[model samples]
Target: MTVFGCRICDTALTVPVSRVALPVHANQKYGNGPGSLAPALEPGTFAVNPLPSGSPWRRWAELEAGEAEALGWYAPRFSISAGPVGQVLLAPGDVHGAVIDPALVGDSACCGLDGGEPNMVCVTCGAPVAIRIDDCGLRQATWLDPLTTHVLEDGPGPHPVLDWADLIDQRPGIPPSEPGGGWHPMWAAAAASALAHLLAASGGDPISIPNHQVAKVFRPTLDRLLDPGSTGPERTLVLAGPDIPDTGGHFALIPEHPQTGELWPVAPPVKPIPLAWDAWRYLAFHRTPKPVGRSVPIPPEALPALLPGHRFEPDGQIFLSVLARLPEVRQPRLRAIYDRGRPYSYTYCSF
Candidate 1:
């Protein structure tokens, strides 16, 4: 358990939180209706250094020659988040003894807060301590400023971290469906990292994915990116994990450790493509529509749900950012894709 408090008064600002190795795409923004927006981190969880945004933006030219390179940035962006350390991200509703500063709000035209610096202040001392971001196009989170906040306490207590077996059994799936009848935005964001590693492992060669609803989400992007005619090796991605539903290929797509964010282990010469645990569960224990007897004279085997017809789309910004961080981007064929900004001339539009 951990409780972060305001440095000035030592008053607890946050509820007891546990460490969470959040996804790489945690910061990737998704467009959501004003009324339906959800916080980035789950309640009772907190992630550190989850790419803090705002105020401390730095231009590519402003960075020292080796600084950007050291940051594993092979390409350039308009600006980079040169934000502060000790950024403990939390759900907005989780913070106690704190309130939003109406005067420091961001993107006034929108229904939610966006990029106001130190928008959150200590309720007791009025000390500027954190940033509250909940804009429509950004991930909603409360970012604790290290200078104004200190960890009052953190220690293991009752709820321990789940091991791989327990996590697999839970089947807390990321359903491809969403509120407005489209593919979930989280799936799209996750595709960025998953696709990056898959492409890198392809070695500028062809790779195939088995036919499955979840696999279909990735197949189009993978095919377009790894054009066999345009590009070394060949591989077929096999859904490999404990009790994963599909099976066969030597090339494995497995879940990283949910708690540690560590990629799963694979034997020599076999590259492990990391899949988010939530998405992995969707593929592993897919719930097919089964027949249920009807008293109202409806068809017995009626479908449970109808998925949207639109193709699964990857978030372009996140996809590019993910690729640039991989060593395989140095490969000319793959590098060209990164340099071009997006994989396709026209991106998949769920909306």
Candidate 2:
């Protein structure tokens, strides 16, 4: 296990946290009531139409499963699965050996604290140490920013390497889905956070999201933020990693090491789009339910579809907070991209 501490004061901020097997995706909610159903669909089987509500086909639908399977959904996206995975928790207090800054605590709509920013500072030096993102509905805990904190190797012996395949293979029973709540709030929050990282990774270049399904969720904000007039080479976002065969791509959204938080690089070295380890793992291994028109029924021997349009609006505050922490956001060209997209707004919604 590794102990994380404040960089400035070297104050031991957290205990040696290890990866624990979880019955569901860390971000997904498995409520005890009748409404919360686990997402049950294969990855890349669905496509989303990100157009406005006025558009005729704004809902999500299954891709031609045979073709999608053959082509492998040549876009960078995540799957929603009803399976078991691993997660880590870093709570505040003596039990976890964490010392959070009382002054740095920020209020959250759902929970009392929002750690998307450098909200947790070092008690000794007052320098930002980590982000504590335990809000209501979210798996409450703190995430130590690798840039601001140092992880020290300690404990009895070397920690066991967390095997991605093992975690993926484990299966847990599906959870109940909420009747009215179609979109998972935590999923939206995590996706919004990932979108911020993707933009910063773009380096002011036009990013091409091949799969319209995933693109629909992000394109609204991206189209507004990216420079249309720029002649820079276009970069395509592809999902490539150990499970998915890398058929040569410019950029990738790869998985992260569960225990260490180190990103697993895509083969051949393409620009990487960062995502939370659980998010990436779920996307890589599980199938997400596709949104369909209300009357449509599940197709036989093919991907399932559902009614109502699913919309994902990147939280403005979360986007800005994450963007500010990234060094790439400082580049003049990247800054121009943000500036050109005046009046930032994410309005993709599902009924």
Candidate 3:
């Protein structure tokens, strides 16, 4: 079989051919999708100008590397600590470019790659360097598993090209109104890149992710809201839509319970407007790629019934899903809120 690949890099000694032609197409390629690849690609012949100082892109790269390295130190609480039998820990979110699976649920050794190997070359740049693949025997390490959503231990650093997954039940958590660490777009982008890198590294394996690992990356807004020192207006609730444009809607996130007067806390004790699947799917898919930190529209009629003294503005266009009862919403005809700001972008709505 003619297993083609770019020759600017080297090949595995165990492979059929020890030396392949230069810049030939490879056996696989992982597009910008779930379960991608993270092979050590050879650097190219040419050198490009460096990025400007303190650019967001530069910071993002550092955050990505930091998050990946952080996985190396994470310990799996689910694994039997009696002693190390044979084990291997995988981080699929690091490998896959998308968040196909989040949270750790169980343990296994093999994971299925969504699109298999990546063979495509980066047209923007070229490679010219020596490369070789060796059977790096597994070392005892810890990482997050995308499929099982757990943290587990396995053989040493830099495992061989093996598809691994842990056998564990999936425990899906309620999707958060604000994904990533915080509501800011920059923070979301950085966190998403790191999380995506972690998933991609796992090769979509089923593994256990420890609670500490989740807490390390997850910044619960609830914590901030409860902090008595926080000044200014706090954020308490969020309303979002799905990736689908026409299906978007909004809801208010409230604490488990409200205390004191109508002047409610804005940041901490927050969740999304209680919505069913129809409304949720729309918000989940249509909501912006990053949280915009905006609130749902409180109709003039409902305003009186809502928390008093708080001003409510129809922030963005509510893409009401046809499948559910239309939210009792009325937008100001003469003025538009969505027109003044960017709308949320979601994966489902891309099509």
TM-score of 3: 0.18
Model 3: lDDT of residue 107: 27
Q: Rate the local accuracy (lDDT) of all candidates.
A: 0.72, 0.49, 0.21
Per-model RMSD to reference: 4.5, 15.5, 23.5
- Higher-ranked by TM-score: 1 or 2: 1
lDDT for predicted candidate 3 compared with the true structure: 0.21
TM-score of each model, in listed order: 0.86, 0.51, 0.18
Q: Per-residue alpha-carbon lDDT of model 3 for 32-143, expressed as tens digits?
A: 2233233212211111111111111222233443342232212111111221121212222122211222122212222432221121121222221111111121111112
Q: Which prediction has more favorable TM-score, 1 or 3? A: 1
Better of 2 and 3 by lDDT: 2
Estimate the lDDT of model 1: 0.72
Off by over 4 Å in 2: 1-160, 171-182, 267-269, 288-308, 336-351
Cα deviation at 77, candidate 3, in Å, is: 29
| Candidate 2, 134-185: lDDT as tens digits | 4543444454555556656545323455466664565321211235746454
